[model samples]
Target: MTQSCVARVTAAYRRIAEADRPEVWITLRPEADVLAEATALDARLAAGEPLPLAGVLVAVKDNIDVAGLPTTAACPAFAYTPEADAPAVRRLLDAGAVVLGKTNLDQFATGLVGTRSPYGPVRNALRPEKISGGSSSGSAVAVALGIADIALGTDTAGSGRVPAALNGIVGIKPTLGLVPTTGVVPAARSYDAVTVFARTLTEAQRAVGVMTGPDDGDPRSRAWPDDVRLAAPSRPRIAVPREEDLAPLSDGGRAAFAAAVKQVEAAGATTAVVDVSPLLLAARLLYDGALVAERYAAVGEFIAGDPSAADPTVAGIILGAAGLPAHALAADQERLDRYRAMARRALSGYDALLLPTTTGHPDIAEVLADPVAVNSRLGTYTNFVNLLDMAAVAVPAGEADGSPFGVSVVTRAFEDQPALDIAALLTGEQAPEPLPGCGVDLAVFGAHLSGQPLNHQLTDSGARYAGEVTTTAAYRLTALGTTPPKPGLVRVGPGGGAPIGGERWTLSPAALGHFIAALPAPMSLGRVELAEGRWVLGFQCDPDSAAGGTDITEHGGWRAYLEAAGEAATG
Candidate 1:
């Protein structure tokens, strides 16, 4: 894998040079410099370094700083060179990913349509005549064009997700502040989130995992919450919009969403219709109400200094918010709190909420003819997300009106894994693992596996199934004579052991403690080694307590052992 970084970087530069899509990039690094970095990464990997993103080529949206590259945010006069990388970029680099260049975006990230850029509109990757959603327009197109393995974008008003939806790629808009936005030009500082775009949901989720953490530079950065679910429930309760709420969808778009809903059901999820009025009302507040004042607060003075330096529509929107009364801002806060509460109640028991990433895919000419109305409509399903402090994963569903149609799976703040899990299910891609260090990963080998009687103990404690695994040959499995038959995994000092099959489960920190505390004697949590990677918290037995237990190692797993004894499925 390390040997391939040079070839991958070479291919990316060639693709960039050959695409003839000048508008997609604002400042590309010299091919030689990028190649040299890739070469260094190859060397590091060969030297026994662990690089999760080794050879992964990344594109940074122009609004986010990439050391040595100018961050234009598609506004030439506002461009500046940063001495260091943004927290997001730094993390990716540390994980062995190399930056390709700075991709274009709407001027100051103010519009949903990609046309607001002074660098020239970023045309859709699939069909040039259509609008590429913004303000992270070029980054999405870059990823779609295969010029980058992972692209970074910012989503304030669906800029990140909308573009990905248009380009038929995976877009990850994490829960607010999950990836610190320090060194990024803020559209709405409090609402802005650095998002990831990749061709596959698995790749997109991996990139997101690399960027998840807290940063001192960003005051809004948050430590991963201990209560968030690391994975979705097996039979998830998915929330869908009321039929009337989808009135904004055109015929093709509506049909595509219906098909997408079918995909969700096929994934073993049960859907429930819910009223989204309060959320929609709050979404309007992003721009139509006092929340727009944050835009003015971000760069209103800069636009004021040289109005001609910014895009007319972007300038107009920012300027309009400049004179709002302070009271309106205060009142809007109270109103938003109420709407959040209502929206929360509406989504109480759901694991994920689904919505079209946008109402429809519009043509560039059509949006150019009527920019504001079309842009607002594009944000119909998206503008409420950040305001309500939620996470959403947007992925291609199918096609609508000859353009790719996509849906956003929304989850409560920090519950991003469930959103990605459902997206993976819809796309038939590999489901993501638990976020590293975010939750406790426990390995179970007995009656607690899926489809077994005692599995509810983990589920009841809010644990989620991470994935299946096989323990190393160093461990042995024994039949523990408990009320509900269980398997005791023991680490034998040497050669007389066999591989054991088990499942890994993720639990919140609080839940793990409670779960372990409730475990019966001889079933304590201990370090159990897997076939690969490091040891994890797993079920183990006191060797002394297992002296009289029947050895079940020859059966390969507890389930297999029980099957031979005609007892595994009895529970």
Candidate 2:
């Protein structure tokens, strides 16, 4: 609004014209109408109206209806001009975002590779020769190329996530049914979700936030649970897929994923390599098992009526499900339920699961020559999400060789905020905000910091890393001569100690009780005042316990003291 909303729209249109990527959009909104809307937006701003999205330009994947625009979903023969916008689109528009147009995608959102669309392939924004991951291909490319601030897409498999990874942007696929899909053409009905794309995690999150709410018209839309944890763990126990699970990863992908693992650890996360075969096994069910019949249920009639009008690859995949026996689908559902339980047990105490978004990025020719295999391989790390009823946020971690590489932070359903926060933490693009009220937050200046000797006690107790914080300048740190060596924290009455750095973690009440019951003499739990003027449960040593201990306050925190001690020992 500051630069004139109309001017922003005009500039975006100019960029789109210069880019000349027709396949990216099946129906570009008339420039005059967009400018008029922007002008109205500017007047609203001038009238002192508050707008959260405020002039944000958006592109909608064609499968999601936009009033006055044809919902082709990249197949012209099935096009329909809707009189009203999809709920997701209307939400963004209501929040002051202006729609650029309806973008192309894999016909009926059936394929991962962008090439399945009859509108023509939506080329990768980075290297035109590379395939833009889809079926949300054009929407992702639009954001990556700076043509739009945000884009709406649909994800049944990896449509939302894969395209964002390939194009180097952020994609947030919320908990299924969290964002209404009422006006969106069904991909797989039960599994499909509306996703938002943006250049940064915050923007994508902001867009998704505005779009989240109940949709009475869409039975899939569910209310976010009132008891869900609001903060991403400041120090989380992350589950990493075993190396074998990544066997299809190219050398460059492996190297990049390794670096991504290190980045998360640096952000205060502790990771354990675990077998994720159950999740992988479940992923195969999407296309390789009876569950794919959902796609058949979605549009089998349209494809059956005129297979010639659909992308043969999409038509073939969806049609294959048409003949699946009803009992077969029922049996697979039972199997999927078992996998879900197994996945939960495997991820029992972890805050999130981190994985490469895809095995690798392929060139357009490679995908064109072998569409199915390439598409399947790309989904190796992505397909099980919706099936498992989880939420995820995909962000760029760095690059693999010369190709852009990214990772997804996957968390249980309704934990969208944490998934997004973890993705933000990895990229160092945004800081996570604390959302208390669900679990007990404990501030630990010593033993329980990630990687510290006694940290396992907290992890074993199901503690989640809340974040790093410092005590108000009224606490002292002391080195206690205990077995395994622990730090003692003591509060000096007033103005007598330094502000001591520490890390915070959240644990269940029962876990906290057990954690305290096992604490040996000299160590105690009490309220500790933070620099932010808030008090949280924390470790505080009895003043007598520190009477004979060596003062380590100058070292700041336990980790720093340990590092200094290690350096001294090495020297």
Candidate 3:
């Protein structure tokens, strides 16, 4: 029997515990409570209720109000029991998503590094020693670790995007006011946005759709034009900053970004080099200019009465904001307005702008040593996003030396759908795999893993696929370099070519047919034997299609081949 979504989420939650929870959460709802929510959702689905999320498990950052949970914003003294769920949280629950619990965050939502929270720093899911980027730290970690399918985080200055980059998940900061922030504790009221974190773009986009719309409760909310609704663009013109503008990125980050740009171009998009200094200047205003005062304005009385209540870093930052002169604040506001206008004009001709989600990932110790400076650096690409009233989605570009690299797609406010659509193009959807007894195991040699070109063919077919898993030795992989890029697989004799590349995925017979029918020319589905003697759907190229292609078998896999090529070019 197929495992239910509730069952999958329960197993995921338990598995997280088995791996040693990362202290990403401040409070977890009792398992019983969660189960109750899940059971109710399953019943609703059985009754044919139109549920958008339908059994999706979601985590809320502690800063956002959830009716039964205390909103701590990672500071105990600042904690308050909200009378009701935040508007965003209410929307998610209404969509059939069950709240897992409240996750930790930067104290008062001040730091980009998750370490500032009194609850303890959130470690990177991929590398325990590294910091989980924040103030959406716990949310990102939770999603990355599969503790939840979707998470709600607030982004003021890169809080949502940075953590997602570090944790290798999708982080979306929708246009300001797109998701109401009425019950969220404000970091910078005008710039604060409820962000989404998910393992895949589909889930993230779905979550956003549920939470969006004009909310009378939030004064900033505005109705989006139906015709201009945010979705993936048919043909995208993406602007990229010149290399000189990205001087702060590490060697690995720069290379990964370049590769990502190439991938986007390969996916049929035109990329233009543009100056982003105006936006960067505006980002500076958030901390260095009058915006700091907004922080002071957000929680002044609470901090003034109990300085000990806030994290030292958060308290210090907020205190510094208090020193800003009123005139300077006015001047900074003027500067922000001017920059916003400049950004609108600059982005008028493009479908979206692409930038590295963060310059580089900093270690936990580095953040502790120079909390403010290091955190500011991580926000280079993200800080200006909300300030400019834009929508952004950060998709994993690829891994660089074991660490993940991500790029953000930005569009004018209310163009969230287009931004998400572009992101889907950049990072194709990888279907969720069925449980062991639910369906047959299949090995995919190409174009179905997250970020691959043709993965959407699998997701749209309702195939349940898991994250990437290496194949057993025995398959021969070839780079056919067909249109839109494709990989071919062929079985060889015993002890033939080593398992060059493959990912274990699954699909129902019906879904498999749908996936096959959607394939473009030059690519077809075939059964290929795995080393383990199992056979499943795999990409096969026409014999003539490999005529002019370079043999890359020695590199073992396309990813390895590309890595080698990049090293050679850079070296």
- Give me the candidate number with maximum TM-score: 1
- Candidate 2 TM-score versus the reference: 0.79
Model 1, 124-171: lDDT tens per residue? Answer: 999999989999999999999989989999999898899989999989
Which 10 residues in a row give candidate 2 its minimum summed lDDT?
430-439
Hey, what RMSD does candidate 3 come out at? 13.8
Model 1 clash tally?
Answer: 0
Which one wins on lDDT? 1
Q: Is candidate 1 or candidate 2 better by TM-score?
A: 1
Per-residue error at 228 for model 2, in Å?
0.6
Residue 130 error for model 1, in Å? 1.1
- List, in order, the clash count of every candidate structure: 0, 3, 10
Where model 2 places Cα greater than 4 Å from the true spot, the runs are 432-571
What is the lDDT of every predicted structure here? 0.89, 0.88, 0.79
Taking all chains together, each candidate's TM-score versus the true structure is: 0.92, 0.79, 0.74
Best-to-worst lDDT order: 1, 2, 3
